[model samples]
Target: MADPVILVDRPAAHVARLLINRPDKRNAIDHAVRQQMAAALSALAGDPDIRALVLGGVAGVFSAGGDLPSMKGLDEAGARARMAHIHGLCRQIAEASLAIVSAVEGIGAGGAIGLALLGDEIVVGEGTRILFPFLRLGLTPDWGQLLTLPRRVGLPAARRLLIGGGPVDGAEAFRIGLADEVTADGQVMTRAIERASALAQLPRDALLRMNRRLEMPSATLSDELAREADDQARCLTGAEFNEGYEAFLARRTPDFSHL
Candidate 1:
């Protein structure tokens, strides 16, 4: 069956809106959601007319990262597999040619935070909650969060989030360089599009080149590439990853079998 976690719409000439549609779960990532997000990104990569994309979640939520229930019963192998796929999506967004703008309202956590950080420009709503709850759960980071967050917000700040459970608000996110702009509630998506529309007007080739520069890993390129592969394999085997996938298929919470 087709993945149902994402909803896509193109309302403007060169702008595409890809909304995370699983509000009931706070737009948490499951296997289905991950597949849909990757597919949507792949489709956008080939659409020449689409110059910019806006990613957000329905209601007030952005995403809470992986569904906890899915992590409940995963073995080490299952967790590693899940991590690999999540990291792949993060890399795909980073390498995509078209500009991406993230409109974050509330709750950007775990892999969800990685997705938002992939944006060339991120616009966040005032008072929105952004956190990285990985260390809190005794899980190593995945989804390019380990690799990208420190680059964008600095290592010290990244550690603060990764190690200390956070519910960082929008203003602080901007102060720490996590957000490009902070808009009033309900205005994030519109503001993000306005910026994206301007970006869409630029020459495509120039924009793409700039995107590549901004996304290039400052770390040794080979190291980053290897790290991506390594992290993915580890995540795939984790018991949490398996549990999460099973819960998603069964439509229930994960049983935390790996722990």
Candidate 2:
């Protein structure tokens, strides 16, 4: 049997690592890879043991995006199906409550950029290239990137990057707020996994609640005050908070492993 295109590994307790295993193809996401990715993410989402995820790629390369060769010779229906398939994958990542970190070493292109941006935090190497070549191909950006990009880089920068813009290297990406952190090529994956592990140390339910609020920020101060009231009420009454309070007085790190 062939090796899986997406390799799932448990690098740490409560943390899963997904390695895109297509170095010869520059980690291009073909249809098969998309399907596999969706399934893997869904499984991880359902796995109560997993609290966070780190997405990396083989050969120090992230992904070259959709494989153009595999994308050719598609009828209208086939094309739509392809888009819908990838959309499902993108939706899975976007809606996931698990803290996700993406390690971009070489390049993150096209649809892959959308996937990378879906991460709660992105770690890019100094030589990493972030590409958005939608216009060059005469296609509007897909994979929910139109929404994710703006959420990451704000409207003006997102607009500029998406419309007739060239690729942005790691430095430019960091300057534009596209990347949460930047590291040397050799350290990108380590940084990403470390970030995910750190997030995993917190209470999972709290992260889910926070993700809910972030997904829908309040438009007014009163609304935000009500939201915070709801958040604090739920948290303060939880066992995690009880332990945390006791730990604060005891001057020790709270052990949230059981929670």
Best by lDDT: 2
TM-score per model over all chains: 0.80, 0.93
Write one digit per residue (lDDT tens) for candidate 2, span 194-219. Answer: 99989988877777788878877899
lDDT of 1 at 244: 65
Q: Which ranges in model 2 have alpha carbons more than 4 Å from their true place? A: none
lDDT of 1 by residue, 115-158 (tens): 87877888888878888888878888777777778988899998
In model 1, which range of ten residues has the least summed lDDT?
202-211
lDDT of 1 at 90: 76
Weakest ten-residue segment in model 2 by summed lDDT: 163-172
